[model samples]
Target: MTRRRSLALRLIVYLAIAQMGGMLLLVPITDFLISASGMAPGWEVAPDDWGEHRIYGLVAGSVTRAETGEAILEPSAALGAYLETNPQARYAAFDCSGVVLRGSSRELVDALGGLDRIRATTLKFKIPGDPDPRARGFLRRAPAASGACAIAAYSYRFAWDDLFAVAALFLTPHSAAVVAPAVLCALAIAWIVVRRGLAPLRSAAADVAAIDVNTLHRRIDVEEAPKEIAPFVEAVNDALTRLNAGMAAQRRFTANAAHELRTPIAIMRAHADNPDDAVFRRDMKRDIRRVQTIVEQLLATARFSMRDACADVDMDLGEAVLAMVADYTPLVIESGRRIEFEPPSEPTIVRADRWALECVVANLLDNALRAEPEGGVIEVRALSTAVVEVVDHGAGVPLAERDKIFEPFWRRDNKSNGTGLGLAISKTLAEQMGGSIGVDATSGGGATFRIGLRKSVVAPPIASFGRVEPQRAEGSVGARRGTA
Candidate 1:
């Protein structure tokens, strides 16, 4: 994955780059302005000479002076002599009245096509250099005499300092000292402002993180967020509101369905009990009982799934477990199974809904009984003040299937007699009460379903009713029990 940079840093980098580009562009702009204003080194203009002309007799006077042995030759002769002395002087000329009075070099005069090419305006000519040819020339009209225009042209090369000056305008020795600190300061200020501006967004994220099914009613503070983000916050709150309504409707449907089915199942059970045929009556009653169990499990699952299902009541863990085991003692006996419950001796209290805990214990015990073979001992032990384990000496759950056993309608064998929701409901109830349930292989054999719960620091009030223990019965069924 590509590493991500913060928005603040990215903004700063972009701004710095833009500033640098702008500064660099200034160099060409400055050069253009200088060139346009006739300030550049090779810039030249033509003078309209309508008065005394200096070049009218310059060539004739120069030849006469050379013959007379004069030190100061005429302008055209002086320029010609200078070119002869300096081979690097590529081009120099003196033009008078549409005629070339004197030429510094024949190459330049030929390139200009005699003197007719020289005009009143500046013109550039390409001249041959040692390595390569470059454009060079400056044209300017000298003072006129007697209606004759005198134009003097010279070739010049740009010096290194000229280029350096243009470059230095954008980047100098102090460029870093000025632009570096300024950009850094701008970035620092921008980061601080941007971070501060996003405070409301950070706060809104925290509030969003804290929201769950229980806090669905709480909405993001739209007013506190910036206007740019307010609309998004409002949309999220609207979605949450819709979600909460849908969840409420679903829960109501489930609860109502379960309640509606329970009454008919109970009535059916009553009718089946009174049937004349013993075989038919027994089969119908068993089927009705299974239906009733499913309905009850559905109701329990729906109840615990609700956000407000947990009741703010402290219940004794040992007492609750013992009571559920006692209630199921007769059922275990009828199934030709033995149950052993070891309740904690001390009062172990936990804050949870009493009904939810009872449902969890009852479901576990029922599962243990169903898994046990005929006359097999099912041990229910409460340990560590807040844990309970139900061990059944039957076929242990396969490792691959243990994770899926608590899912609704998931059964190891598809033909098993139960609705396959007992363990699912039990797991849901345990979690709702801030507890967890899992199954492990027993040391000897079979499977052990362990439940861990949160223990309450505050002890519950003592009830006036005395504790009830499990009673042993005759037959192939028996129970070893205790009470807190």
Candidate 2:
């Protein structure tokens, strides 16, 4: 998979480059204004020159031109004479017309360099044709053609090369400060625009990725999402709605068909057995009962499995368990298994349907009775917060079969004569009631089946009236008779 570049780093890089670029252009703009407005007297500026300036000063000595493409050397001889006359003649230059023709200041003229290095080469050839305003004023001549550069060259010393070198350094870096912020601002604006524009795409992708078959009945709440993504969300939700409706119709048809077939099977089984054959009749009756249990469990599973569409209310879980126990006592006792129950001291109210909670308890008790050996004990306990546990002393199920026990028709031993749907039905019912059921190892060394239900918020009475009469703490209600 290809990785994406980060928006922040890209923003920083682009902004920095833009800032540096703007600074480059800013330097020339600033140079034009500063040099133009700050011109001084004796400075010669020109029309065709764009933006360059040069200035000159007063005369201290003179030089006469000679004809052999060379100077007469009068200024050198004069300078030698002046040096002899005064030991303190420190620096000098020959300014002629509007330009400096020669100089004696070592730092200035040596940097400008020797006579042959001066391009125009002679005293007569090196002057501007017309003086600029500042130059005309300084020279005191309307036309600067007659003198200033020559007079100033003989008078004072200036480091022209040094002045230019220093100006270039200060000007460029200074221009960067003035222009960088605006360029950075523009780039920042661009980044915000890009990120904001892409937000809808990100949200739509998350919504699409989050969709699943289990949640197909749910639609994205597009009114609460970004406007740009509303249309796509609507389209996806429409597709999901159609798929869910078709699936729901198919399930309804299958359940209805199965239910229709059950009545005919029951009628056929009733006619198949002859009343005269006692043994055959008893076995046929048991088989028919088994088939009836299986059909009832199937119907219950299908009804409760559509949990998302069901509405539940608060129910007394303790009462629900007690009712099932009372109804199943005959069957349990007939099987020769001792069934014991521990009711909570307080009402254990939970959020669930009364019928659903009863079904769950009935299925669990039935499983416990069947699993326990004849004359063995089955214990039931209830607590606050709607928790109930039914335990049985039997050949406990293997660890590997625990998970499979909750799957439809998954019997550990096929010869046990069970429909194998009890636990599976109980699981579905518990989940529908917003609860859970599982088997855990009992502290007393048997398998304890636990049913956990949602706790209620209201304060419950200490008594709720459906409990059986009190019995001894450690002894069965009828231990000698083997009744619990």
Candidate 3:
């Protein structure tokens, strides 16, 4: 059933404890300095040994200026009465001419260390005018309002306790004892201030807890946040904004996937009653394949989250492309289309997933086959700088459609036989592998899909390790794979 203290409360309590500890140590030091240092005002004011300040005030008050513009000693009735009642108080004033302005005798004033030289005696000294010849007294000299010198002397019984009482005016006896209650009051006020200060943050946390996919548009009000945490609130709001955009995109993707799946199902349903018809059956199979392609592309998109496609992969680009081309050679021939290969002169080392590399090439080739005219030669080239280009000899893609070709399910021709996800999947896979795919107009009226990957470092061939070219076709360049 214990409550945890907040950071602010903890800090306040710690400082208060430190202050109490300091006071605990300081009181003794001050006491020692007062007793042993002979009344130096290091931690306390100067010692009031024998009421020097009181006598000085009394003597200074009685001296006044006359209406005739001359220094005069006109003791007030109260001062005169005090002097009469208290026989122990002796004071004397002298004019600028060394004449006794207010004294019984000049000899007694000189004996008490007269105003000829003005000074204060910190300790008690022997003096006359008191009943005891060796009475302890304090002597002080002051200046009159009329530029005349004056002196005050008073005697009293000696007591160490009285001396300590006079020196201990800075801190009273219960000074340290008062800290506990003061700290408690301060802690209560601090707790209230801390709670009120964190009110906006608590509200923001509640708002954040309520957020979901549907309510992603809700934003934290920055004005309510304290200035110290305003930037943190703004950063959270920015993350929410990003999440909202991603959710919107995901919603669009889901709607499109549903619509795409619905089309093939509807097409298959329309052909259900005519299975004996050859054209309907062919169309049905094609729709089935289209559905399969959509499902597979969706699966491929899901796989993006399953594994790290950006993992380090090192292999030879030329040898990899050569092997991929060999595998797809039968498909090209079956479709009555010819394919050509042009590998790099040397080992084209590159960093890419071998399966993803082959998959991207397969997608590009599939896209190129659909776009290329019958019997058109599709060219696959692997450059030395870790680049692969798939050039198709067909009507080149228009500049306006090139940008949209890579978007998921985007199609220039809605009636085109193939799904539009090939390029999109290729682009996703390429980006995940730290590569990029783009399309440009081929030099001879076709579209060239370019795939660029990070070039991997490869060791140069030694004199004994010369490159051996494979003799497959005229102008076909291939080499042994080498990588660092």
Candidate 4:
């Protein structure tokens, strides 16, 4: 990725440039203000040559040749209208030999260095403000081809179009003197403001950079942040909070899984010392089964949460429960108990992942068996509403504990069986298949774990939801002792 430019630096640069540009442009305008305010005589008058240049303009336009080729003044013409009121008041033209020209008297010529100089340059004059009406002015000599020099004086004025003369007004040594030091100071101030204004953002960035798994709980101080970015900082802190929780849960899960596995291994190692004993063989088998159950529960939990792990398919609720009850019957009998199944009154179809559903049902059955008293009949039922219930006459779960039991590694007491992961694994698998499993008090006295299965579409053939089987009604289902 291309590196981003600094916004603070760019803003500071822009501000400094604007200040310098405005200052440079102000020089010509300041001259205009002074000259127009009649203060030109008091301060730097008329920007140094504007009045002298204007005097020469009148001399150039109004001077003309007489029939005898002599320089003469004609202020009454259209180009000389500015002098119409007081033509000779600011006008003078002198011939080379101190001879009085047509515009001004010999007394004015004496003031202009009469006859002593062959040619004359611009010379400053106060030119009385009467009829010319502005206090400050300048005089300049204009010579015609006929060898007559004319002197004219005028006050200054400012115009609107004078503003576009950026190069003429600003590209000067005088403008440079005012602009350089001021621009340097302006730039320095802009840099300082930018740095101080961005201090909070820099602090927030430093806080974020320091965070790792162990420090995720630390948050950026929102009080110090500007309102414009407070929401963004809060969002980052929220993400960190979630990351911290997930990491902590993962660590606890890993440690608990290890501890559960080690206990069975220790039991099996003791059993190996009495290999020939029947009790040792039995106990070894039981311990190995416990280890296998814990491993399977952990595997199911970790993998089922993956997006592609669920293969949802339409299955008949009665048929699936009947199958589960059949598989779990032998285990129930071996434990000196019985299992029963009840089919739905009508065909009930559900969408579920086959492997995930089996694991969930097996976990439910395993949990029931552990809680059931000897010779107790464990019941499996499929209601017409696409629900499966595993009923056991064990101590019913308390209301508060029901929600907690679905959490990983939560158990009622230290004597809890099967790693306390069966219900958690079942919850994970059911949710992944877009189904729900919950427990309530069984009637008469026990825990009733109910599964609300996903509604299945049996009409339109879905290639991924598995093949739909023909509905076959059966007699009241019985797995072992009693008809469910």
Taking the candidates one at a time, how many backbone clashes does each contain? 6, 8, 0, 0
lDDT of 2 by residue, 243-262 (tens): 89857754654564465456
The whole-model C-alpha lDDT of candidate 4 against the native structure comes to 0.70
Best by lDDT: 4
User: Which candidate ranks first by TM-score, i.e. highest?
Assistant: 3
Better of 2 and 3 by lDDT: 3
Candidate 1, residues 189-236: lDDT per residue as tens digits?
Answer: 877888898789889989999999888889889988899999989998
Q: What is the TM-score of candidate 3?
A: 0.58
Clashes of 3: 0
lDDT per residue as tens, model 3, 1-484: 8988677767667867766655655664465557456655454333334345444555667777667765566767766765665666566666545566643334456666543444443334555454665345444445535345545455533234443343443255576457667767767777788778788888999989999888999999999888988999999999999988867766666776788889889989878977777789668766776677677766776776466555557887877887888877766765667777777766667888887888799888777877778777788888877799999988888998988988876877767654566788899889888999999999879999999998877662432223444444432323333342
Give the whole-model CA lDDT for all candidates, comma-separated.
0.64, 0.58, 0.69, 0.70
lDDT of 4 by residue, 70-176 (tens): 66766546435544533443555656564655655444555445332544476555534245444444445664553455454444432243344433546679877
CA shift at 18, candidate 2, in angstroms?
A: 26
Is 1 or 3 the stronger prediction by lDDT? 3
The candidate with the higher TM-score, 2 or 3, is: 3
- Assess candidate 2 and give its TM-score to the true structure: 0.43
The candidate with the higher TM-score, 2 or 4, is 4
Runs in model 2 deviating more than 4 A are 1-272, 277-285, 304-308, 443-445, 462-484
RMSD of each: 19.6, 18.4, 16.4, 11.6
Candidate 4 Cα deviation (angstroms), residue 184: 14
Candidate 3 residue 154 Cα shift, in angstroms, is 28
